[model samples]
Target: MKKEKQYINIFIIFLFILVSLLMIIPLVRNGRINAYSDWTFHSARVQQIYLNLQRGNLLTFIATDVSQHTGVGTFLFYPYLFLYPWAIFKLVVSPVTAFYLWYASITLLTLIISYYSMMRFSKENYVQSLIFAFVYMLVPYRLYLGQVVLGEFIAATFLPLVFLGLYEILWGDLKKWYLLSIGMSLLVYSHILSVYLSCQVIALIFAGYLILSKISIKRIKVLLYSAILTIFLSLPVVVLFITDFIGKGIATTFTGIAIEPEFNSVIVDSFRNWNGFNIGLILMVTFIIGGVIVRKNKQLKYIYVLGVLLTIAATSVVPWYMFSNTILGKVQLTNRYFSFGDLFLAVIASYGLSRLFDKKLDIVRKSILMFLISIGSVFIFYASSTWVLQETHTYNKELYLLLQPKKKNGVPKIPDRVQLDNNNYNYQFEYRSLTGSSDYYPIKAYDNQSKVDSILNQETYINGKRRKLIGRYNTNTIKYRISLKSKSRVDLPVIKYNHTEVYVNNNLIKNSRISDRGTIDLTLDKGMNNINIKYQPNFSFYTCVIISAIIWLLLFIYIVKVW
Candidate 1:
C-alpha cells in the first residue's frame, strides 16, 4: 500500500508538470515566452547585479528617470523578490542564466499556485486541479503581460502559499503562523500594488470571519502574529519606501488625474471575443447558479456572493457605474489592473464544479456539459495561442526593422539646446539639423521620452510626480536656432565635449571633460544663456567595485542569518 501511494504521488507530480507544459508551449513558440518590455529593464538590472556579482558586488540596482527631484524612481525597487531564486541560481551559473532560471521557475510556480490553492481551498483531486490550473494560466491578463517581465509574476507566486498558510492557521495543525507571515511579507516586497490589493481581499475575509464567529484568544493570536511577522519580513520594501517617501508623495499628485482609454468599437469587440466561445467560464457560472439553487455550504455563501460581485466588477460588466468609476477606474481599468478577481472566479468555479460533478449527474447531462466545456477549451486555447504568436512575430519584425544598419547620407551637427516636454505617449523620436552631419553619434538622451517608454510594458504605481515627454519625436535641423528659457539654475547638459562650444553671456568657456552631465555653479543673472552640449560615446566604464563589495558583504551576512 505504501509503495502504491508513493507511485501515485509521483504520477500526480508528473501530471502537474504536463499541465504546466501545455500552458507554456504557446508562449515558448511565440519567441516571447520569457518576460518582455519593462521586464527587459528589470532583466537588465538583474544583469547589472550579475555584473556586480562577477566583480563580487551586492548592492541593489538604482534607476533615474523623469522625476529627478528626490530620486523618484528609487522607491519602486524590490530586492527580495529578485534575490530569493537569484542567490540559488548564482551558485553554479552566470547571472543571465540565473535570471532566466528564475523567470522559468516563476512561470512554473504560477501553475503550482493554482494546484495548491485548489487542494487547500477545495476538495478537488489532481485532475480537477490540473484543469483549473490550465484555465488560470490562460487568464487574459497573465497572457497579455507574459512578455513584460516584472516583479508581479514573482510576487504572484505567493498568493497560493498565502492562502494555504491562512488555511493552516484557521484549521490545520500549524501552531505558529510564522510561515504564513513570511509568505505575506514576501508579497509585500514583490510588488506593492499586488500586495495592496491582496491585503484588501484578505481584510474582507477577516471581516467576514469576524461577523460569523465569536473571537477567540487563538484566533487573535494567529492574526497578531501573522501581521507582526509580515511587517518584519517586509522591512526591505519598507526601507526602500522610506528612502523615497517624499518623492512618492509628489508622484501621487501627478498621477492623481484619471484618464479613460477610448478604443474603437471594433477593437472593443475583437478584445471581448474569445476563440471557441470559452464555455468553461460559462459552465462555471452555470454551476455557481446551480450551487445557489441547491444551497450547498451556507457558511461559504459570502464567498460565492462576493466572488460573483468581484467577477462582475473585474469585467466592468457591473450595472453600478458609480461604483465602477470611483473604485475600479481609479485603480486603472477593471481587467488590466486586478486579476486577483481570477481567484474569486476560481473559488466560485470550484464550489460550482464540486456540486455539478457530485453523485446526482445522469449520463446525458454530464456528457453534454463535458462536450461544451471541451469545445470552449479548444476555442480559448486556439484564440489565445494564435494571438500570442502574432504579437511575438510582430514585435520581432519591428525589432529587426529598428536594428537594421543604415548608411549615413549626410553630416551630423550638434544641437545648441534641447527642449523637452514634461503628456507624450510614443517614444519614437527624430533629431534633425540641416547643419548637422549624417554621421551617427550615439548619446544616451536623458528625458521624459525614455521614462514613459520604460514603464509602458508594465503596470507600476510610481510614488512621485513626473514630467511627460514633450513630443513623440525630437527634431533638429540646420536652418533653425535652438533656444531655451532659463530657470533659477542652469544645468548644462554634459556631453563628450567633442566639437561643442558653450557661451555664457557671450563668453566662451574653454574647459572640457569626459563627464556627460555638467553642472553650472555660476549664478545666472536672470535671462538667457547659450548652452551647447555635443557628445560622442567614449565608452567610459563605471567602476562600482567598492560599492559592489560592500553590498555583497551585507547580502552574504543577511543570507547566512536567514538560512
Candidate 2:
C-alpha cells in the first residue's frame, strides 16, 4: 500500500510539472516576455522597490517618479506582499526574467498549496485531492485573470487554502486555528480589495456552518483567535491604507455623477465583462452534479450551496449600484466574487470524479470513466495553451515595444528654467518620474499660462522669480534655492501628503499646507532662501512597522517549531 501511494505521489508530481510547462508554452515560444495589460505598471512598481533598496531605504512607501517627479505614495495605498518576491528576484536577474520567475513560482506554489489543502479535506482520497488541485489551478477564469490582473490571480490562488483552513477551524480540529490565521493574513496581504470580498465569503461560510453543524465554545474561541491573529499580522498594511484613505477623504465623496441604469442591462454587462471565456455555464452544471453526488457529505453540500450563491451574486442579480454607492465601492468590482464561486465548483467537480471512480463501479463503466477523464484533460490543455498563445501574441504585438527599455547615453540635465505649465506633460518616457498624473501638483499655470511661459523663457524662473535650482533632488527629498526678487509666495510643484514637511533656510515652516490641487504651498521671504522639502511618515507608521515585524518574527519561529 505504501509503495502504491508513493507511486501515485510520483505520478501526481510529474503531472503537475507537465501542466506547469504547458501553461508557460506561450512565454517560452516568445523568448521575449509577456507585457500584458498592467504587466508594465506592476513590473515598474517592483523596479521601484529594487531601486529604493539600492538607495539604502528599507521601507519604501513613496514612488519618486510618479506625479511627474513630485512623487506619490504608491506602496502606501497598494499592498506590497506580492511585490517583495519579484523585487528580490530582480536583484539577481533581469526585470523581465524576474517577472516570469515570480509568475512561475506563484503558479507552482498555487498548485502545491491547493493539492495539500485538498488532501487535508479529502483525508485518504489522494486521487480526488489531486484532481481538485489540478482543476482549481487550470480553472479558465483564473487563467484569464492571470494574464490581466495579477493581484486577483494571487488572491484566487490562495482561496482554496483559505477555505480549507476555515473548514478545519469550523468543522475539524481547534488546534488548526493557526491555519486560518495564516491563510487570512496571506489573502489580506496579497490584495486589499480581495481581502474585503474574502471577508464576506468567510462570513457566509461561518453562518452556513452554524446552520448545518453543531458549534462548540471551543470552536467559537478558535474562530475569534484566528480573526484576531489575522488582523494583528496585517495591522501594518491595514493601518497604512486606512491612514492614507482618511487623510485623502477617498471614501466620503464620489468624483463622478451617479447614473442609474436598467437592472437587467447592469447584470448582463457585469456578467459579460467578467466572464472572459463564458466558463460560468460549465461551473454551474458541474457544481449541481457535484452537489448531488456529495449530498450525503454535509461539508461538501454547504460548499456547493455557497458556490452557487456567490456565483449568482457575482452576476448582475444583486443590486451592485447600491453597494457601489455605499461602502462596497471601495472594492470597485462585484464580479471578483466569482473567484470564490469557481473554487467551490472545482471542489465539487473533484467530488463527482471521486464518486465515479469508486471500487464498486463495473470494469466497463470504469474504462468509460477513464476515457472521459482523458478527453477532458486533453481539452483543458488545448484550451489553456491556445488561450495563452493568443493572449501573449496580442500583448507582444501591441504593448511589448512600449515597455521595452530604451538605451540612454547619460542622465538628462534638468533645465535651469523649469516651466510650471498647466498642460499635462506626458510622462510615458519619463521612467524616473514616480507618477504619470499631474492632478496632484499645484501650479500657477492653470489660469496664467502666458505668465508661466514668459517665466520659462527667462534664465532663472518658475513663477516669475529668479529661483536657482540648488542641492540634490530625489524622490523623497527636494532642495532648491529661491532668490526671490521680492518677498513672494513660491509654490513648489509637489503633491502634498499629511507627512510632507517644508523647511526654508534650515528652519521648519510651521504653516506649510497642501493646496487644493494637492501641491505644497510655501511662503518665501526675500534674499537667497534655501528651500528643502521631505516626506516623513508619522510616529504611528513607525510604531506599526516595528510591532508588525516583531509579530511576524514570532509567528515564523512558532510555525517552524510547531510544524
Candidate 3:
C-alpha cells in the first residue's frame, strides 16, 4: 500500500508538470497574441484595467481612454473581476508576456477545478477526474474562446465548481453551499453572458431534476441557500448590469437587434474547421458511446440527455431563428450553448472511459489509450487555432510595439499615451469596443463616434468662447483648472452619465446640466476653479460592493475551515 501511494503521488506530480509545461505550445509557436476578431478589444481592456489599477482606481467603471478619448462605459455593463487578475499581471510584465502567463494560469485553474469536480462526481476516481479536466479544457469551443481572448470561456474555469456545488447540494454533502456561491459569483465577475447562459442551463437541470425525483423541502432549501448567497456575493456586478441596462443610459451594439447565425454543418463542426466552434469529434463520439454504455447511473443518464439537447440547440436542430426577437435570441450566438454542452458531455465521457482506462487495465492498453487521447487533444487545439490565430489581420502586429530584435539596444519604453481605434463592428463578427461588440456607448456619443477626432480636437466651449482647454485624465477621473473673470458657464469635453458627478474645488454640484455634446455643463465661479469630472455610481453600487465583499470574505473563511 505504501509503494502504491508513492507511485500515485509521483504520477500526480507528473500530471501537474505536464499540464503546466504544455501551456507553452502557443507562446513558443507564436510569440504574441494575434489581433483576431476580439484581440484588439480584449488587449485594450487589459491595458485600460492596468492603467486604472496603476492610478489606484480600485473600482473601475468608466474608461477614460478609448474612442479618441471619448472613453467607453463597458465596465458598467460587463463584469471585470476575472480581468483583474490579467490586468495585475500587466502591471509587472510586458503585454505579450503578460497575456501568455494569464493564459497558462487560466488553464491551470480550469484543470484543477475541473479535476476536483469530476472526482466528486466519479466518487473519487482519479482517472475519471483527469479525463474530465482534459475534456473540459481541451474542447474546441472553450479553447476557441481563449484563442480570441473572449471572456465568457474564462468564466468556464469555475463551471466545474458550479457543477460540484449542485451535486453536493442535491445529492451529496449538503454543507458545502459556498462552492456554488463561489462558482456563480466568479462567473458573474468574469462574464455577464456566461451568468445568463448558466442560469438558463441551471433552470433546465432543475426542471429535469424536479421531474425525475420526488420534490423535497430540504433539497429546495439547500438550492435556494446556494442561490441567495451567490446573488449577494455577485450583487456588485448584478446591480451594475441592472442599473446600466434598465436605465437605458447607453446604446449597445446588439441592444435591440436580434441576430441568428446560419448554422455550420454538424459534420464539419465535429471534425475540424476554419469555421466557428462546436463540440468536436472526440466529445461527440464519447458522448454517444458513453451515454449508451454507462446506463446504470441515472445521474449520468441525465448528463447524457442534457448534452444531447444542448448540442441540438447549438446546431440547426432547434429552430433558433423563430425566436430571434425573443429573449432567447438575446443570447446572440447559438454556439454559446455548446459551452454547457461540452461540460455535461465531458462528465459523461469521463465516466464511460473510467472503467476502460482503469489502473487495473493492461499497461499496453492504458498506454495506447492515453496516447490516442493526447494526440486527439493536440489535434483539437490545432484545429481550433486554424482560423483565428493563423489568419488574424493583426497577427504580425505586436500588442503595442514590435519587439526590438536581439542585440539591439535602446528598446522602446512604454508610451505615456496609448491610442485605441474604434475598430467598430461591421457585422462580420469583428468588433473592438473592447468587447465582441461596441456595447454600452451613450447614444449621443455613438452617433458622434465618427467625429471623435473633431470632438476631441475642437476647442472647448467656455463662456460661449472657444478655448483649447483639456483636463488631466486618469482612467476614471479628469481634472481641469480653469481661471475666469466673473461667473461663467463652461462646457468640458468630459462625457456625463446620469451617475457622473461634477465637483468644483471639492464642492459637489448637484443639479448639474449636460452640454449640447452630451457632456457635463458647469457654471464656474470667478478666479481659479478646480473641476473634477468622474463617474460616481449611486448608493446601491457601494452597498452592493460592500455586501459582495463581506459575502466573499465569509466564503473564503468557510473554504479554509471546511475544505
Candidate 4:
C-alpha cells in the first residue's frame, strides 16, 4: 500500500509538469517577441558569449559592455544571464520540440518543490497538488514578464526550492536543516532580485515561527542549526556576491538610489497597461480565499497570509516599494518581486477548494461547481493576459537575405568598417541583405563613454545628407567615432561624480568647479581624431569592510547553527 501511494505521488508530479509545459508551448516555435527591452539585451549577450566560445575568444566573452538601454556596463557572464542558450537547439530540433523539453525541465523542478511543500503542510491528494502547481505556474505577470519578457524563466525554478527549504527548516523534519540551507544558497545564485525578495518573505516566516512554535531551547537550536547549515552551504554564492559587488563598483551603482521613480508610475507600468496580462483581480481573490481556507493550518496559513499582506503593503501601503526603490534609486519600479505572492495565493486557493470539496458537503455538486468557476476565472484571466509571440514571420528576414550571398560562398561579404563625420556622421549597413529586417542591425549609440542615458541632443547625417541613425554607439574611440563634428561648445557638459576625466583630442578636460559640468569646447581636425573618456569608481574602505564583515558573520552563524 505504501509503495503504491509513492507511485501515485510520482504520477501526480509528472502530470502537473506535463500540464505546465502545454501552457508555454507557443514560445518554442516563434521568432522573438517584441516585449521587454531586457529580453533583447539578455538574448544578445547570450549569443555573443556563444559566438566567442566558438571563436576561442575567452577574454572577449568575459568583458563588460555598455548596455544601450541601461546606459551601464553589464556583467555579461553572470549565470542565468539569458535564455537563448536553450534556444540554440533550434538549429537541430524544431522549436516546438525544444520548448517542450525546456518547459518540462522548468516545471518538473517546480513540481518537486511544490509537492514537498504540500506534503509537509497537509495530507492533500494528487488532484489538490496538481491544482496548486497549475495555478502557481499560470500567473499572468509571471507568464508575461518573467517567462516571456525577461527570459528569467530560470527564476521560477529556483524560487520553489527556496520555499521548500523554508518549509523544512521551519516545520518539517529537523535533520533536513542542512538541505534547507543548501536550498537558500542555491537561490542566491539564481537571481539576486528574487533572492532579496525571498529573504524578506523568509524573515516574516521566521518571526512567525519564533512566536508560535512553542518556543523552546530545542526549537531554537533547530532553527539556528538550520541557519548555520544553510550559510555553510551558501559559501559559493557568498563568494560570487562579494566578487560581483566589488567588481561592479557598488558605490557608484548606489548613486541611482536618489533618483528612483515614484510608486504611481510603477503601478501604471507594471499593471495598468496589462492588456490582459496583469491579473491583479484574480490574484487578490485567490489569496483571500486561500487565507480563509488555510487558517487551521497555522504553518501554511502564515506564509500565504503574510505573503499577501506584505505584497499588498509593499506595492501599495507600506514603503516597501518606495523604500526599495529609494534604496535602489535609479532602478525602475516594476513590481515583479510581488510575483512570488501570486504563486502562493493560487496554491492556497486551489488547495482550499480541493479541501472544501473533500468534506463531502451535502451540496457537493454545487460546491464543486462553484470551486470550478473560481479556478476557471483564473484560467480566463490567464488566457486574456497571455501573449502569443508572433512567429509567423521572423524579424531578421533582412539579415537572412543579406546572408544569401554567403550561400554561394563560404562567408558573407559583411562591411568590415565605415567612416563618418559630424556633417555626415550617421552610417547604416546591413550585415545581411534582408529588406525591412529589424534583427540584423540592432544598435544603440552612446554620446559619452558611460552609455547610461538616452541620447537627447545628437543629430544624424548619412552620406552628407541628414538621416536618423538607426541606433547609438560610443563617440570615444577613433574606430568608433567614424565621423567628427564641431567641437566648440558654449557650456560644459556635466560629469558625474564617479567619473574622472572627459577627454578631447587625447587631452584631459578638468572640471572647473566641484559641481561644474564636465563639458568642453574644442575644434577637431578634418580627418581621424581619437576621443576617449575613462571612469574609475572610488570605493569606501570603511563601508566595504564593515558590510563584508557583517555578511560573513551572518553566514557563519547560519552555517554553524545548521551544522
Candidate 5:
C-alpha cells in the first residue's frame, strides 16, 4: 500500500506539471513568444531588479529607470517580492525565458501546494485533491488574471497554504500557528491588494468558525499569536509601504466607475466575458454539493460560507462603493474577490468529491457519475483553452508588433538634454536613450526638458561665483571635471531620493540638497572638481531588511523541526 501510494503521488505530480505546460500552450504554440497586456510593464520591472542586483545593490528600493527622466521609487512603493524569482532566473537565463520560467514555475507550485493543502483537509483523499488542484489552476478567472495581472496570479499561489494554516490555527494543533504567519507574510510580499482582500476573507472565515465551533481560550490565544507573528514578520514591508503612501499618497485612486447598484447587464458581462468571475457550471455544482455533504464539518462549513459571501461580493449588486471610495480603494478593483471565491469553491468541490467516493454506491451508478464528471471536466478545459487562445491572438496581433526590438543603425548621438517623450510606457524612452545612444545621460531624468537642459548645458553659479563644465561623464558614478573659477553650487542631473549621496573629490559632501527640479545640488570647490553622484541604501532600510531576513530564517527552522 505504501509503494502504491508513492506511485500515485508521483503520477499526481506528473499530471500537475503536464497541466501547467498545457496552460502555456498558446504561448509556445507556432514557435512564437506572445505578450500579455501587462507583460511589458512586468518585464521592465524584472529587468530593473536584475540589473540593480547585478550592480551590487542588494536591497533595491529606488528604480532609476522609470517615470521618463525623473526616476520613481518602485520597490519603495510597490510590492516587488513576486519579481525576485524572475530576477534570480535571469541570472542564469535570458530575460524572456526567465519570465516564462517564472510563470510556469508559479503555476506548478500553485498546483502542488493546492493538492497538499487539500489532502491535509480531506484526510489524504488523493483523487479528490488532484481534482481540486486541477480545477483551481484552470479556473477561468485565474487564467485571465495570469495573462493580465501577474501580481494577483502570484498571490493566488499562496492562498491555499494560507487557508491550510488558518485551519490548523483555528481548529487543529495550536502549535501550527506558524503556518498562518508564513502564508500571510508571503501574501503581503506578493501584492498589497491581494493582502487586503485576503485579510477580509480570512476574517469572514474566522467569524464563521466562531459561530459554528465552541470558542476556547487556546484557540483565541493561538489566533492572536498567529496574527502577531504575521504582522511582526511583515513589519518591514508594512513600514516601507506606509512610508511611501504617506509620501506619495496611494498608488491609485477610486473614480466611482467600478461601483454597480443592480445585478444586471454589467454583472452578466463580467461572468460571460471572461473578466475573472466565471465559476463555470461544473465547479458551481460541485461546490453546492460539497457544502450540503460537509454541512456538519465546522471548518469546511465556514469555507463554504466564505465562498458564498465572496461570490456575492464579486458581483455588481454589492455596495462596492463603500470599499472602493474609502482607503481600501488602493486595491483598485472589486472583481479580485472572485480569485478568493474560486479558491474556496475549489476546496469545497474537492470535499464533495471525497464524500461522494466515501458513500456505498453501486458500481453502475458510480461509473455513470464518473462519466458525467469526466465530460464536465473536458468541457471546462475546452472553454478555458479557447479563451486563452483568443486572448493570446488578440495580444499578439495588437501589441506584440509594437514591442519588437528596433535595431540601432548607427551610433546614435545623445541630445543636449534627455528628451522626455510621451512614450513613457515600458520605460521606452529610457531604454532608447540609454542603450541606443553613445552619450551618457540619466535614463529617467526629470521631465521638464527646459529645466534639465538649463541645468546640464552651460555653467552654474552660486553666490555670484561662476563654474565652468570642463568635462562631464558617467560610469558607475556620475563624474564631472568642473573648472570652478570660484567656489560655487552646481547642480547635477541626478534625482534626489532618501538613498542618494554625493561626494566632492573623495570626501562625502555633508550638505547636499535637491534642486527645485529634483536634481542633486552640490557646492563645488574652486579649481578642477571631481564630483561623483550615486545611490546607496540608508542604514534604516538595511536594518529592516536584515531583521526581516533573520525572522524568516528562524521561522523556516521552526517549520522544518516542528511541522
Candidate 6:
C-alpha cells in the first residue's frame, strides 16, 4: 500500500512535468528559441564550457576563444559548476539541441526539487505538494526565465529548497539545516547578483519571523551553521570574486540596475512583457483569496503579509528614481524581487486550496484547472507582447535578429570580428562575445572609446620597442615564432589576472611578468623563439574545490544517516 502510494505520487508528478513541457514543444520543433533577453550570453557560456571540457579543461574560468580569442574571465564570477553536465552533454548533441536539452533538464530538476521541498513542508500532503511544485515552476515570470535563460533563472530554480530550509530552521525541523546550505550553495553557483537579491529577501523573512516568535538559541545555531557551510561550499567562487574585486581595480560591471523601473507591474500587467517583471493576475487573486480563507496557521499569515511587502518591492512602491544611484538601486533590476516573492504567494495559494477543498479529488481538480489557466494566460500574453514589441520597438526586433545568429558548420557563428571591431559597439555583445565585455577586465582599460579602440586595434600583439613576432595560437596557450633584431622586453596585448602563467621555451616567467595594463610582459631573446602562454586557476581554487567536495560529502552522509 505504501509503495503504491509512492508510485502514484511519482506518476502524478511526471504527468505535471509532461504538461508543463508541452509549452516548449513548438519552440523546439521550429528551432525558434525565445530570443527575449540574456539567452545569447548563456549560449556563449555553454559553448565555452563545452569547448574547455573537450580539451579536458574541467574548470573553465576563462573563455579563451570567445570574443575573437581575446579571452574573457566570465567563469571567474559567474556560478557555472551546474553547467558542467550540460557542457558534457554537448559531446554527442548539436549546440542547439544541447542548449534545449540543458533547459529541459533545468525544468525537470526544478519540478522535482520543488516537489520535495513542499513535500517536506506539507508533511506528505501529496496533492498540495505537487500543486506547490507545479505553481512555483509555472509562475509567469519564471516562464520568462524559461525563455531567456538568465543566470538568475538558474539561481531561482533552487529557491523552494531555500524556502524549505528556512522553514525548517524557523518553524519546522531544525535537523534539515543541510537543505538550506545546499540550496544557497547552488544559488551562489548560479548567479552572484541573485545571491545579493535573495539575501535581501532572507533578511526580510528573518526580521518578520523575529517579531512573531522568540529566537531560540538552537535555531540560531542552525542558521549560523547553515551560513558557515554555504560560505565554505562557495569558497571557490566567493574567493575568486573577493580577490578580483578587491585586489584588482575591476570597476563595477553592471550599468542597468534601475533602467526598467516603469516595466515593474503588480496584479494587472499593462504589457505582456514576460521577463519576470510582473505580478500575474492568478497570484494576486490567489493571495487575496487565500489570506481570507485560511486563517489557521500564524506562519501562513506571516507569509501572507510578507507576500504583500514583496509585491510592493517588486512593483517599485518605493520611488526608484530617488534611489537610482544609492545602494537600493544595486538590486541589478527592481523587477527581480518577483523571482522569490511569487514563491510565498504560491505556497499560500496551494495550501489554502488544499485546506479549503475537504476532499482529495477537489484539491487535485482545482490545482489542474488553475495550472491550465496559467499556461494559457502566459502563452497569450507572451505572443501578444512579442507582436506589440515588434511593431512598437524597433530595437528589440534588431536585437531579436542579432541574438538568434545563423549557424555555420553545425554551430552558431559570431559575426566577423573586423567588421564589429571597426563599425560599432553593442551592449548585447557583452553577453554573447568573449572580448570587450569590460565585465571583469581592469576598469581603466575599457574606460573610454579611445582606450577600447587601442586595445582592439593593437595590430602587433608584441609591444616591445624593437622586437616583433607573429604566429598562430589556440585556447589556453599561444605559440609564436619570432625573429628579433635584439633581445628586448615586450608586452603582449593579452589581459592577465588571477593565476595566469607565461612560458618562453619551456621556462616559467613568474613575478614581474604582468604589465600595468594587465598585459603579458616578457623579455624575448635575439633569435627565432617559441613562446607559450597558459592560464590555470591555481592553488586556491583547487583547494576550495577539494575542501567543498569533502564538506558536501559529509553533509550528504549526515542527511542520509538521519533520514
What CA root-mean-square deviation does each model show from the true structure?
12.7, 7.7, 6.6, 11.6, 7.5, 5.7
Query: Quick one: how many clashes does candidate 2 have?
Result: 8
Error of 1 at 75 (Å): 7.2
Question: Per-model C-alpha lDDT, please?
Answer: 0.43, 0.62, 0.68, 0.45, 0.62, 0.65
Candidate 5: deviation at residue 504, Å?
Answer: 4.5
Model 3 per-residue lDDT tens digits across residues 386-437: 6444533243323333322332221122222222212211111111233333
Per-residue lDDT tens digits for candidate 2, residues 1-563, read 67756665665666666556555555645444433444444555676677766777766666554322444555666667788888888788755456666776777778778888888888857657767776776666676667556778888878887888888888876666788788878887787678778888888877767777787778888888888988888887778766665656322212222333333553443334232532333454675466677779876777787777777666556677667656666555555766888788778887886765675555456445544553465456455556445544533333333321433332122221121111211222243321112222224332343432222222233454434342444647767777766777665555566677788899998868654434566767778998777788788888887887788899889878986
Regarding lDDT, does 3 or 4 come out ahead?
3
Candidate 2, after superposition: displacement of residue 76 in Å? 0.8
User: lDDT at 483 for candidate 5?
Assistant: 69
Global fold similarity of model 2 (TM-score): 0.77
Candidate 5 lDDT, tens digit per residue, 1-563?
Answer: 67756766776677667666655555544323344444444555676677777776556654444322223455555578778888898888654456667778898998899889888777777767877887787777777667657878889999988888888888766777787888888898887668778888788777777787788888888878888888778877876655444553222322343633233543443345343456655455644565676678866676787777776677667767677667656555666777887888888877666565745555445445444444454456556556445544433333333332433331122222221111222333233332111111222333444554443333344543444443332222345666667777776545555555678888888757866655678777789877766556556656777788898888889778874
Residues 1-563, model 4: lDDT tens digits: 57656665665654555455554555444433332234434434443344444444432212112222111223321444324434454334543344345545665666666665655555645556656665565555555554343434567665665676667656676565555555565565455556556676777777877777766566567767766655554444454345434443222222122222244543444344233234354455665466677778865676677657644543434444445545433333335555666666766766666665554433435334434543563454345444344322244342222222313222222232221111111112212111111111112222232211111122222222322222222221111243445432222122222333445556765652221112222344455545443333234323443564576577668768975
The Cα RMSD of model 6 versus the native structure comes to 5.7
Q: lDDT of candidate 2 vs native?
A: 0.62
Question: Highest TM-score, which number?
Answer: 6
| Pick by lDDT: 1 or 4, better one | 4
Best by lDDT: 3
Off by over 4 Å in 2: 1-18, 31-37, 247-284, 358-382, 385-388, 394-475, 478-483, 527-532
Indicate whether candidate 5 or candidate 6 has the larger TM-score.
6
Estimated TM-score per prediction? 0.58, 0.77, 0.81, 0.59, 0.75, 0.83
Off by over 4 Å in 6: 34-36, 242-245, 263-267, 270-276, 287-290, 355-436, 456-475, 487-489
lDDT of 1 at 534: 21
User: By TM-score, how accurate is candidate 1?
Assistant: 0.58
